[model samples]
Target: MSSYYGRPVLKEPVWKVPDVPAYLYLGGMAGASSSMALLAGLTGRQRLARTGRLAAAVGATASVGALVHDLGRPMRFLNMLRVVKLTSPLSVGSWILAPFSGLAGAAAASDVTGLLPVPGRAAGVVAGVLAPAMTTYTAVLLADTAVPGWHEAYRELPFVFAGSAVASAGAVGMVSAPAESAPARRMAVSGSVLELAASRRMEGRLGLAAEAYRTGRAGMVLRAARAATAVGAGLALLAGRSRAAGIAAGACLTLGSIATRYGVFEAGRETARDPRYVVDPQRERLRERESAGRGEVH
Candidate 1:
């Protein structure tokens, strides 16, 4: 409720639209697709594995491009690799992205060219090992910032991100592989459930900060994401052997995943542009601490 000349109390994130959100969505998809590729390979679903690998490669390459573009210089990204700082999410994320891109590319090339079978499989395995971390690290990176909406939702953001990643990967699988790829449909349904549940829980728990996610551009995008995901999940369940239904479901899920990333990004920006979203929760925390102190004294 307070402001300096009616201006925001915190500096808004300088991250640009499309670039940052695209990076988030693509990185998540790449990571989860790598994991799916690993699973498909182990299960002897070679076609699905190949599709997953290719998707991962493409997503990773584009994600890195988006990141470099956002930074305004490719060397700026390289500079982040100068030293490893475990305490910094940006540093950790940089390390994760670099290796993930290389591994995903190697795996995809091997799958497509039918060469370097041994090394390619190894790269896929390693990429799969790093996939979970890659999918969720962006959430940590966002929550580490001062933005009220993102910071307040830290506990659920990783789950939300991971679910979105898996759903996106599943959508890719469904679109590229045959309708017989039951694993893809299963992943879509499960991932959508997780994403929606986590999002709802995050909003309910955020109290005042949740307003950022429900009252503007962020709200509209997220509402659309939820609708798409839910409908896609239902369609996937009823798709059976219908290729058309599967494709439709996949398209919806993919859009949902994209919207989720953009919506969250916008919510953080919204919170940063408002003083109340920053001050209210902080004041609440201080009051809570004071109340606890008095209780202890009594």
Candidate 2:
């Protein structure tokens, strides 16, 4: 078909902006709640522990809902369970998420009324272990897509998502738990440190994959990500034992992480549609082919 631009115009996601807001809410909740669950298990705070566990369960449950709701056919989401495929990240993720959700729910449910006896503690342990991936998988989910910026930022994206998750969890601690949440502050601090370290590594570590951090909308997003992750992480540590400071740090991380995710999504779409992503790479391939042809003839 003929076109004014001779190509597809850039567009936003197919889903309604309102119908499916980004996974920010759920991702953050899951990340933050895990830390709380850990704190509960470690510190022996029954009520907050239960609360965190419940939060994680609720967040994971809702996130899955959002993901399916946003799909072209929400009912078809279950089709992923029929078979296992290692080659497909989505398949792997579906499997990973399945048990994680169950464990998180079990832990949360167990915590609610304190009825698990031995099984509840075991469930909490399981949830705590998987918490990291629960937060990090969203990055993998995005990277697995054909989306350019997301795939490009694969290495760093995980770290970015991780940082955001940690920060978010800290926020939950600050808000729902208690002023005496010493461990909550510590978890927030730990999360901040990990996020900062990972993000810094992201910028210098990956090669061409790192380009997502350097140009256009991606650049702006990465810059903001660095600032937020840095400040939030730094401040969270400094905020040690202060619920207010901890919460603020959590909020900072939350905002920064959200911006980072949105920016990433936007950048991915930008990269996908732009000819450079497809054309330039192929141009290099063609040149290499021509050079090889001449070499064979000579």
The best candidate by TM-score is 1
lDDT of 1 by residue, 1-298 (tens): 7787999999999998889999999999999999999999999999999988999999999999999999999999999999999999999999999999999999999889989999999999999999999899999999999899999899999999999999999889888987346898898999999999999999999999898899899999999999999999988886666888888999999999999999999999999998999888889999999999999999
**lDDT score for residue 290 of model 2:** 100
Give one digit per residue, the lDDT tens place, for model 2 in 217-269: 77787678668767777667766556576667767777776666666666566
Q: Going through the candidates in order, what is the number of backbone clashes in each?
A: 0, 2
In model 1, what lDDT does residue 180 have? Answer: 40
The Cα local distance difference test for each model comes to 0.93, 0.68
Instruction: Show where candidate 2 strays beyond 4 Å.
Output: 1-5, 8-21, 28-32, 43-48, 72-74, 200-222, 285-298
Cα deviation of 63 in candidate 1 (Å)?
0.3
Relative to the unseen true structure, what is the C-alpha lDDT of residue 274 in candidate 2, on a scale of 0 to 100?
Answer: 63
